[model samples]
Target: MALQIFETDPDARPAPKVKSEYTRPAFTFRSGMQRNRKPVKLDNWRIVAEELEPLKALAELLGGTAEEYSASAREPFHVLTETDSVEIVIDGAGAVEERMILWGPNGPIHECDGVEFLSPADAKGKPCGCPKELDQRKAWAQQGRGPKPNIPIRFRLAGLGYELGFGLLRISAWTFLPDLDPLKAALAAIDGEALCTLELEHISFINDKGEKIEYSKPKITVQGAYADAIAEER
Candidate 1:
């Protein structure tokens, strides 16, 4: 069943039992996507940022664990467009909190958590464009960080490159419990704010002609959160 995007409808997207590691099984460019079969597959990514671990780090990285919950949502989109749409859920320090859903081609669509170079704006202070930012990040992810991410997410047939984003859960890829552990993990002790921001990056795929197509330098906003906390320190 589709998860309702509005609060008036308090329907939780039933947790897909954690048979494997990625319980949520979001869009990953590597697996199931028959890249060899279908030329392009669209992935709707939404970004939402929330800082909830403030009081924790008021002294250190964070005080005790803060039970915060959030979600990354996109419009009932059959395909991503020149404009995007989405929403967010944030609970901060058991106090200051709220939600701000957005509409635009480049808004956030998923609950991302990290120092991700969110958009072209985030890459501003640096040299080059989004392509540069992505190259650097991809190389960084290659440093053997246990479970590799769903790298090279493709959302269109724009050729050469597609927008990119990732969800970082602090827990190990090995951390899996039978029941609702995965769901609990996704919406667990999230004191740190999730960054549902935007950006344009390159991704890999094949063309209709069954040839390698490299999505080069298109502005795709990847609004995801780092599944860890970055509080002010308590």
Candidate 2:
């Protein structure tokens, strides 16, 4: 056989890369805020994005004002809209796993599943040495010695003709842990086709010291299929 040299086509173009819908969320849904080293839980969801147009559109559809904020030089400008509840359709399975994430000034320093490390490549799979008791684990997390829960749920806004792309909601509150399994089961039962309402529930109670505490917890309620929901509304 004779050796031959092949020439590449000058105009040949590579196929474009396709990004996962979940990975390209248009906005983020936040349930809490921080001020002066204290956490502030909001009774409504705060929808934030780097772009203003989508947030303006969202405000129009959701009956809230979209306002822009000047962030630090290292941070991008933010546009946010607040609403008590929003209808969302989780088309398919998104990131719903419960993991512990500990962040430093740069980024995540450690990630684990309580029993084993899942990040920092060199330490992956090693025993994380987290406290077995929930209270102790919470204490460790509070003291910045352990990781905190990070459960992310991504979905498309149900209304607005489903044209606003996706919104990511990360649930980091330890109090919400008890509801994860049921929510996952509900999402799986419908094959991720259910119309769900993401809202904040105001929780108030008295502690052992007779001190009254009030806060809000994010809640997800499955409202069945989108079409069925619309038909019922009609």
* Candidate 1 segments whose C-alpha is farther than 4 A from its true place: 1-79, 83-190, 198-200, 204-212, 215-234
- In candidate 2, stretches whose alpha carbon ends up further than 4 angstroms from where it belongs are 1-21, 35-38, 73-82, 230-234
Report lDDT per candidate. 0.28, 0.77
The digit string of per-residue lDDT tens for model 2 on 1-234 reads 753333355355455789854546678887766667698777667777777778878777766677655464222333344578877887644446678998999999879998999988899999988889999999989999989999888787876666777778888889999998888878777743778888888889999999999988788888777667777888
| Model 1 lDDT per residue over 1-234, tens place | 864575555565455666642222122111112234574533422222133222222112112232222333231111122222222222222222112111235653321212332334655334322123534534433443211122222121111111222222111111111212333344335544332222324468988999996532213222333333223222
The TM-scores of all predictions, comma-separated, are 0.19, 0.82
Q: Which ten residues in a row have the lowest lDDT in candidate 1?
A: 168-177
Clashing pairs in 2: none
